[model samples]
Target: MAGILPKLIVFMAIFITLLTVIVDGESHSFSKTLPLRSKKLKREKMSHLHFYFHDIVSGRNPTAIKVAEAESTKTSPTEFGKMVIIDDPLTEKPEATSKLVGRAQGIYAMASQSELGLLMTLNYCFMEGKYNGSTLSILGRNTVMSEVREMPVVGGSGLVRFSRGYAHAKTQWFNHTTKDGVVEYNVYVIHY
Candidate 1:
């Protein structure tokens, strides 16, 4: 009877531990958790599109006049470099406007590193502002490395979040020619 009681107690302890693990695992949450693969398609369909630009060589300027003009005027461009037009709407308030402009500049800086064939680095800038009459919170910035291949594509998605919204920017650069080593770049952004 004593031996049977000890074995039963061990079994009960293992069962309780397993139950505790299952409950705790289901409750963990991060502020910026990524969507599961099954949910990605649905989320992408509802997301607004934004454009990202990269300059892949030093001293070379953007060939597109429209892109240059938009940068000089501090207006966001729908299409630039290898990017295409998309329907991401900006928040109409002055505070939100400024924040987006600042973010654009930061993107430019990060892209410049890709020009030198280096991986870009993005840091968390918890700047304060307002968006849609609500307090704006800068979650964090994610830096994705560019790759050189036959058809260049951004390796991973870079993400930035606000209090009520978030943005994903992806970028890549490929060496198109060995002679003079011309590099081609493409960037994509999606907002939700």
Candidate 2:
């Protein structure tokens, strides 16, 4: 009877702690703590964002090598070559044409050494139009191969919270002389 009583008490405690909640989009109140993935919340839908990044890498921009030599540290990240903050234009450049569009403001830094290729990280924001104020992050290897690179969208902000998806990047043009280039991205996201 003692063991049975303890089990019954535990069951009742759990039952009492359970709650019913109603979220009205704008505001929400939580009576009980629940996992963020609770099905009681609204169902998640997939979202997509596709845009082109026109990185016209001007010579005026400081290279990572210059930064490393300038900083001259005895320890860590001794070789920095390609860390850059992006302020590129996002275009809806189809196969046939390219159009003026929004802007992409973000940072890309070298996270690891290049054994096969350079592994970089992205924390980028989209400004203007439907995706205004949305930010996406990624950790990907940068290689100028003909094959498209797939980048995982780790997380996001604004309308892209709880974001998880993949972005396909294709280099359109890379100028060896001027050090300018155009890269196109097709991003797919699922967020709540």
Candidate 3:
């Protein structure tokens, strides 16, 4: 009976180990033992998308709105602490009446006290052609007065899955009094 008890304990331990492995197999499929290629995300490619972003803060139908600001924001040199939420239009051309391609929807804030630097977190959601319903996320810094500002394309969804790249933004035209701007965006991205 003593020998039988020891054998039964060993059997229980082996059974539990096998059960755990089977239950957790899907969650740990890409563990150290498995190679990344096993998942089969192959034939990566790069794409460049050019568009114009219109940020209108003046008119009654503004696209970008100042949603929040600190008490000292109005007096600050760079308006640091002012945050704006935007649903700006993305067009094929710099003109506001150009063909619409997508929308830049997100928030940006003045994050630098010494310079007019903004922390941008937005998504370029495409609505035309093969990119319809796809989105590319941008999260980086933008120095407003600079000749060219490069922002990172962190990730994406739909057609641009597992994407990473950068976007070059050049202010084509800006109205000082109205605080409206038209920015040209050239995005280069790598995706599978």
Model 1 lDDT on a 0 to 1 scale:
0.31
Ranking by lDDT: 3, 2, 1
Write model 3 residue lDDT over 104-160, tens digit each, in one string. Answer: 999999999999999999999999999999999999999999999999999999889
RMSD, one per candidate, in order: 14.3, 7.8, 4.7
**What TM-score quantifies how close candidate 3 is to the native fold?**
0.82
Candidate 3 residue spans exceeding 4 A from truth: 1-40
TM-score for each prediction? 0.28, 0.61, 0.82
The whole-model C-alpha lDDT of candidate 3 against the native structure comes to 0.96
Give the per-residue lDDT of model 2 (tens digit) for 136-168.
777676654546988788888777777899888
lDDT of each: 0.31, 0.64, 0.96
Candidate scoring better on lDDT of 2 and 3: 3
Best by TM-score: 3
Query: Clashes in each model (backbone N, CA, C under 3 Å)?
Result: 0, 0, 0
lDDT of 1 by residue, 1-192 (tens): 989999999999999988986876654455334555544433432223232333223234432112222343333232122221111123212221222311222222222222322122222222234212222222232333334322212222223221123444433233445211222222222322
Model 1 quality (TM-score): 0.28
